[model samples]
Target: MMASRILMQRVCCVLVRDLRGSSSYSSSLTASATVQPFLSRTVLRSSCRSVSFNVQDHDDFTERVINSQLPVLIDFHAQWCGPCKILGPRLEKAIAKQKGRIAMAKVDIDEHTDLAIEYGVSAVPTVIAMRGGDVIDQFVGIKDEDQLDSFVEQLIGQ
Candidate 1:
């Protein structure tokens, strides 16, 4: 019984260590864990705010992107897409460098299927640039940070 208790303690320690190291653990475990309230408040505060945000719905898209005074860059992506994840941060970084001249809208294909279909997005990580609610430029695939910077510059007519 003593040896079993020691093994259980070791297992608990390993589980705690793994949870602390993982990025998704805060979201997945906080709701059900006893330390939920504290974790939710602290963990949810940290998010990407440099140059873009997750577009919530169709109405939000209309207000935030189409009606925006600034040129908007829309990134159509899916959570399960590996290339989308790779390209997203790079695009954000490029947009951040542009200051307030441009804005970025992120659309998850799984959540916004209609938007994806309307835009004729056949694959993940399709980026479209819009000005005056019209598509000015677009590209599909992973672009390096430098290429993304050039793309943003072109969109803003710099």
Candidate 2:
């Protein structure tokens, strides 16, 4: 019964995406060039009015990410991993760019193995975007700012 229900849920998600169509999703994601990424972290951290990005404990991923009132983007990462190191700060930068629009958090797989296993996060930089306890989207591997912008924009449909 549980397996069937889970399968149904997956089907529904796919159906929704197909029905909505990918082009619409893409267009809304990059509607304008308003989301330009900062060229350097130092300048970004220095110049613009700083937007708040909080680093939370691993145990708090569910409380902060899945159940969030605002759309939450979570970077499931580990400390020893090289790609994770590169992606972690990049994820932070992305969050800061659209600070008010999105809530961002991360889970350290080494510290919190359960979240990593539960989410099936086998890779270093698996970013899952969630809203109201449902996963809305995900991005794997290295993503440049424009890609990040579009990925995030897909989650933030008007």
Highest TM-score model number: 1
Clashing pairs in 2: none
- Which regions of candidate 1 fall more than 4 Å away from where they truly are? 1-50
Query: Once model 2 is optimally superposed onto the true structure by TM-score, how far is the C-alpha of residue 52 displaced, in angstroms?
Result: 6.9
RMSD of 2: 16.5
lDDT values for all models: 0.81, 0.66
Across 1-158, the per-residue lDDT of candidate 1 in tens digits comes to: 63464345445555555777988776867567665654445333333223476788899799888998889999999999999999998988898888777899999999999999999999988999998889999999998888998899998883
RMSD of each: 13.5, 16.5
Clashing pairs in 1: none
Model 2: runs farther than 4 Å from truth? 1-59
When summed lDDT is taken over every stretch of 10 residues in candidate 1, the lowest stretch is 42-51
**Alpha-carbon TM-score of each model against the true structure:** 0.68, 0.61
Model 2, position 136: C-alpha lDDT score: 78
User: Which one wins on lDDT?
Assistant: 1
